[model samples]
Target: MIKTIKHFTISSLLYGLLFTSCDLDRLPMEGPSTGNFPANEQEAILGLNGAYQSISTLDAASTPIWHVMDNITDVGYARPGNNYTSPITSSVTTDNALATKPWQYHYRTIARVHLVLDNLSNLETSMDEGSYLQLAAELRFVRAYCYSQLIELYGNVPLLRHAVGLDNADVPRTPKAEIQQFILDEMSEIAEHLPINQSAYGHVRASRIAAYMLKARVALYAKRYAVAAEAAKKGLEYAEGIHDLTSFNATIDVAGKDHRAGEPDVSNIFGHEGYANSAEWIWVAEYSIAAGNTHNRQYYGASRLGKGVCYWGPTQNFIDSFQALDGLPIDESPLYDAQRPFENRDPRLDLYCVRPASRFMGYQFQPQTEHRTVFNYWPVNNGSSSEPSSVTNTDATNAYRSFSGYLWRKHLDLNDFNSTSVSGESELNVGIFRLAELFLIYAEAKIEANELDGSVYSAINKIRQRAHMPPLTEGLTQQQLRSALRYERKIELANDGLRWYDLRRWGIATDVMNGYLYLNRAGNGWSTNTLQYIDENHNPVYNHNEATKHFTTQTVIYKENKDEYWPIPASEMDANKQLIQNPGY
Candidate 1:
């Protein structure tokens, strides 16, 4: 087992409590202060672990914040509530927990990092030079990561380089560009302090390659395409033999007797097993029941029939985004049949989501009422003498099940199925950075820069080959290549917490989100002409008149300037007078 520095020890908890009394700017008046703590190498490591504990706090809800983030975007939907529905519909308030938590938690992490950095130099004489520098670099990476998330979500935020007392706590919001530059510069400076590969350390800690990938991502988000491509190239060079894509785990047939070669199963990559033995993962946030750091991932992602409430799921728009087997979109492909939609689509559609009539966990997952009972496939696999029997399909009958009529199977694990219950928590590690995402980043940055070449095609084809899809055709224009790149990112990275950022960065959220979000709880087929076309951004466009006749519709609105970024929390504004809220709040 890998010994990750993610344990929520007593000292880490106490350090977290020190910043709980106020917002990011204030320090604790009655707890362990930085002055008397982290006085040695052991305490320094403990303090660093405290900084890492903020990652667990991100799972403030039923699932990690990253998994829940896509629910508010165009691709996924959450259980209906103000917190989930209001953001996508442009009615969210400054006091909403979803909007406030990101601001609060990210700043709290930044403060904790500053606390450790402020006193880390005291033990330099006792520790080796390389160890001391590596410790500082790791802490800086954590701070830079927090700022990266903040600038993406909230735009401009207060940038504090060091720990501050109450007198100097209030600071004005810095321009997002400056902070982006600071992140780029800091990542460049600290990349050498970290190791190139941390496989011996369980791939949980930040490595030199991970820092370059972060730099590339930040630069791409800022539209610095050349810089992004260069950083990505460096990262890929370092990761040549160290990291690559992991093949999907084989899926068992319904009889539990045969394994299918065509079916794609990602349980080994995104599930608990991936944390232990996945080469594709570059940096991870590890969770362990043994260390008392975990979240209810399977509890939120599994279906009601599988002992989960099904709090989040994919939207109909997302389901239609997958291409036909021929690598052409459903609307343009001759292989597509509206009546047999699930048969000839990309394998990832089934790999990532559980639609009606699909086998999930141990039962046939039919979310429509027509299927009263589904065949149970677990008994035979578990060595029971009794044959498989029909069981109540609670997923179809439960009032609070998935609103979109689909459930996520991406990060869920079959090994945890028997253990899943209302009270069960999952220790599956969440990926922070992975090799597949890095490849997509390189391809996208190169495409945007109009630097298309064999390398770009190789980067994209590697991902497609892994998914059993055809590679991009030769002699395509830059516009067509952009669409292809967008398609890859939308499908390959769906529900991985990056769609909302992609929509805004691509300037298509307003166009795609203002319309109605479609659903098909009955799993009914549509007319051949129901889908108008696939848009340039790879979003499926539907004919409204024909769509509502067969599918359920939900209204969504996105304001041009306002919904692009969330409002600064009301508490932060009241606590710091210098903080100016984002525009149109």
Candidate 2:
């Protein structure tokens, strides 16, 4: 019943800005009525497309919105230069721009769907029921998605089922539990009508599996473990046939000036080009040079393979979360070497970050080293085995040249063209939903339900095997499996912008991120408090011969919140007297 026609024609429209005329202040004294729009199926498709447009705001490569999700978590650190320190370690307020923007954007998306939904009742011409159901399901799916995000971010939010007029629009907040049930029910009703597969790339139309996935994720967040487990299982029924953990290695040119093979695990799974219309993609935020953050994503967090702000970096705590290839933590495994911290870690860790001496984009990035004369190890009498680097502090703000010293490597465009800056036409894409995530969902839900069957082990191991890590120990207890699930999600889904939510869903944000996050700094020829590297007692001087001042810890404290939700935008509270702010705002 889902419409095969995809894509919106109304590209000019943006977050809640309806343009009546080209003139800024001038309105036509008399304009065509709303009745004139979408008289046929072709036009209705455009209206549906317009509803889907708001999703672009969620793309990390395009906007600053994702910074909220990435920075507020324990896994990542916000660059101090952009002044994102507040989101990371300060008290978040209702006036926070990150809190307000997502509210406006999601509602704007919801409102667009309301247009199609509201007009469906007034359609003058006859339309097929199958076609009508398909259109209706698509809108409902989008609406549910927006509400789901609102529920995750704000907790209790107004569920606007249909479009509202500009005047008389004060709506009260609905309890989150009620909204959660409503979404599950609504998706169940629409599942029979949606397509089994989306007809085109970047389209918002859901297949039955997408609906199940949404339900599974929502139920998991809702803590309906049994419901989540069953829904995830059903989702896998549709997923297993169409998508697999398998990936292909293609020799693609980097901006046609350099050549590199796709990363074995994740590189091929993401990005707009090369993988377009690939079966593994369940949902994505599609964009073009016409409308995308090709420049913005490159500007921040991306590697210096292109010019970037390096506005964010991962913490040493997150880096340590990766297990050795032998399926043991660095502390447990004999492979770990304190002198060379990044070596022999999980392969994905290197793929996802620009660590001390890792290679990427034809450059050996060393963020923790001092200037050229400085090597990480003592190279003279008591020297290090590590090689030296010309590029010290590779991941840092250009203004300050200081950072947490780790850079996120996922979704970065490393071609020669964007090697220093984006052309505003970068072809990177955002993955909204993928099969690998579903596997985790199923595994996590099963663990939560205390039902660690063979399927649970199979699901979790598929992702582990792809990353080329050893399989988990078989026949583990439920508690042990839960621990395994936590690590799997952390390493597998790092920097994909989901860890923040995971911290909340697992009810461990306070325990995991509350205290000081330790960042280890080590370099040769540096002075220390213990005078190990210092030769003088009163006037401290470095030996410059020993790897002294070896490693020091920097702390960033994350406060535990009374409630898991972010504050509702202060402006919304002021505008709507009936609206209540979330706890601890």
**lDDT tens digits, residues 27-107, model 1?**
221122457557788777766776676765686466888898898988899888899889988998999889888887777
Residue 270 error, candidate 2, Å:
2.0
Model 1 poorest ten-residue lDDT run: 252-261
**Cα deviation in Å at residue 99, candidate 1?**
0.7
How far residue 16's Cα lies from its native spot in candidate 2, in Å, is 10
C-alpha-based local distance difference test score of model 2: 0.61
Compute each candidate's TM-score over C-alphas: 0.94, 0.82
TM-score, predicted candidate 1 vs. hidden true structure: 0.94
Q: What tens digits encode model 2's per-residue C-alpha lDDT throughout 307-350? A: 56566677656766676667777655677555555556677776
Please report how far candidate 2 places residue 170 from its true position, in Å.
1.2
For model 1 the local lDDT of residue 219 reads 98
lDDT (Cα, 0-100) at 562 in candidate 2: 38
Local distance difference test scores for all models:
0.81, 0.61
